[model samples]
Target: MSFVIAVDGPAASGKGTVASGLARELGLPHLDSGLLYRAVGRALQVAGGDPDDAAAATETARRLDPHDLEDPALRTREAGEAASRVAVHAGVRAALLDFQHAFAAQEPGAVIDGRDIGTVIAPDAPAKLFVTASPEVRAHRRWLQLKDQGVSLDEILADIALRDERDSARSTAPLVQAKDAVLLDTSEMTIEQAADAARRIVEAARARWETSLKGEASQKG
Candidate 1:
């Protein structure tokens, strides 16, 4: 059996960093589930397909190669918007569902991070964290990241707000924290601080899950 850690959050939150840190601490493989949608979105852009066209978007997702996810372009604002657009299609989401599930079921364990990992992809995961920050704090982080590249803080803030709206309002796999997920608000927390807190949470959750499993085994035996 595999232990799964599902970390879900909106754009620009520290989920990716926290997930990476947690995976390193736990010796588990990590998957950025959003990259799957970004891959499809990039494919659509390359093929001149309309993101709003469900059939086109679904076809793009169905034909996606895992290699395509390695593209650095998927991290761009345009690609993120495209991803949000294509992700609204249920068929597109279904096309990528199995891929995400396979990643989560890896031997030993896995850490998967994205908007819907907790609520949809890995609802039974042993550790689920909903990482978030205020829009202002997240936007500031983005600004600091791209300031040298000539992007404005105001533009980044607007983009973050708009992306949040689209992601939360999407029909399929909307951005929502699962009921049992522990919330990690990083608005006032530094990266090191966030990672420390996350480590504690996952350790506790994993202990509980392992105890439950042992109890079940005893009952069965």
Candidate 2:
């Protein structure tokens, strides 16, 4: 039985950082599934394709090179906005689903983070977390990150709001907490605290998994 940890959250909610930290702690592979959408968006932009064209985006997503997806340029606000726009396309989401699932299947276990990881991408994952924070807090965090990169604070805040609206309003895979997912509100938690809380959740899930396996073995015997 493969173990998977699905971390879902909105932009700047700290899911990515927490997921990465948990994966490192557990010696597991980590997948930032948002990068898959960003990669498709970037590829579409490079091809001069229409961001609203679902078919074009899906085709681009199907052939995306994971290597090209890691370019630092994808981290820019423009790329993020474009990615959010393209993410509304159902076809594009479908195209990348299998790739995300395949990554989660890697042995020992794997951690995947994105808006829909717990709900859409890895619904069966034993450990599912929905990390979130107030919009103001999230905006402030994004503002600080962009400020370090020389982007204006006002522009960063505006971009954050716009991205939040788009992500929450998208028709396909709109950002929402999965019914069975454990919610972690990070509004008052430091990164270290949030990561530690997430680690505890995963540890509890791991314990359950082991006990279940032991029961199965006893039944077989």
Candidate 3:
């Protein structure tokens, strides 16, 4: 069985960093699932479509080429905001469902990070983490990443707050923590510390998974 790890959290929560690091340590492929949404959003923007148009956003998501995710433009703040808008559409979420599932079904396993990875995309993943940090800290971190663009810290903080509200209030696959997931609050931790804590969590989950497999085998003997 593939040992899938689903990492879910709000924007700027450092879930992506943790997921990528864990994937490397475990020799598993990693998927930054948010990039898929960002691609859809960016495409819609370039086409002059309104993000709130469910049909248009859904079509954009359906037609998204995996290669489009490599576009560096999708990493920008504008693309991220657009993604948040499009993501609220149930149709858009439905369109991308299969893509995420396929990634988790790969050999060995995979590490996937996004808002709904644990609660919606990969609920049965063996290792699930819900990473988070305080809003102020998260805003600060995000500002640091984009300060070169001349965006003010206050503007970024407000944007983060709006995104959080939208994500949690969305009707479809809302951002939430899975009941079985371990929560890692990185509010005060350094990147290295957060990564270390994530490794320990996954290691524990892996051991439990192996023991369950052994128990099943013994029962069949």
Candidate 4:
């Protein structure tokens, strides 16, 4: 029985860093699911497709080569914005769903982080965490990150707000907390503290999964 930890959160919520730390602590593979959407956006841009064209976005997603997604250029603000636009398309989300699920099923277990991982992609995951922070805090975090990259702080804050609205209002798999997921508010927490708390949750879930698996095996035996 493979153990899966699904971490869901909005942008700049620190979920990604927490997920990576938990995965490292547990020796599990970590999948940043947002990368899938960004890959499609980057692909479309490179192919000269308009970001606002849903049909073009869907086609790009359908034909996406995960290998090509490894380009460091995909991590830029422009690509992230483009990805948010494409992510609202149902076809684009559907195209990337299977790849995320496959990664979650890998051996020893896996840690997956994204907007919908806990709710839509890995609902049955043994451990589910919904990490978040106040919108102001999230925006501030994004502002600083972009500022460090030489971007204007005011523009970055406005973009963060817009992206948050778009992500939460999308019809398909909108970002929301899963009912059974543990909610971690990192509004004032350090990365190490968030990671430690998440590790404790995962450890508890792993124990439960092991116990359940043992019971099933005993019944079969």
lDDT of 3 by residue, 154-212 (tens): 99999999999999999899998999999999999999999999999999999999999
Model 1 deviation from the true structure expressed as Cα RMSD, one decimal place = 1.1
Q: Say which prediction, candidate 1 or candidate 3, comes out ahead on lDDT.
A: 3
> Per-residue alpha-carbon lDDT of model 1 for 119-176, expressed as tens digits?
9999999999999999999999988877887889999999999889999998788999
Model 2 clash count equals 0
Estimate candidate 4's RMSD in Å.
1.5
TM-score of each model, in listed order: 0.97, 0.93, 0.99, 0.94
Each prediction's whole-model lDDT (CA)? 0.92, 0.87, 0.95, 0.87
lDDT, candidate 4, 1-221, per-residue tens: 56889999988899989999988887888988888888888888988988779888988888888786688977788888998999999989998888887898888789999999889998899899999988788878877766667787677778878988999999999999999899999998988888888888888888888999999999999
Candidate 3 residue spans exceeding 4 A from truth: none
lDDT of 2 by residue, 30-105 (tens): 9988888888888888889877898999899989887976798888776787799889999999989888878978
- Global lDDT of model 3: 0.95
State, as a TM-score between 0 and 1, how close model 3 is to the true structure.
0.99
Evaluate model 1: give its TM-score: 0.97
| 73 Cα displacement, candidate 2 (Å) | 0.6
TM-score winner among the candidates? 3
Ranking by TM-score: 3, 1, 4, 2
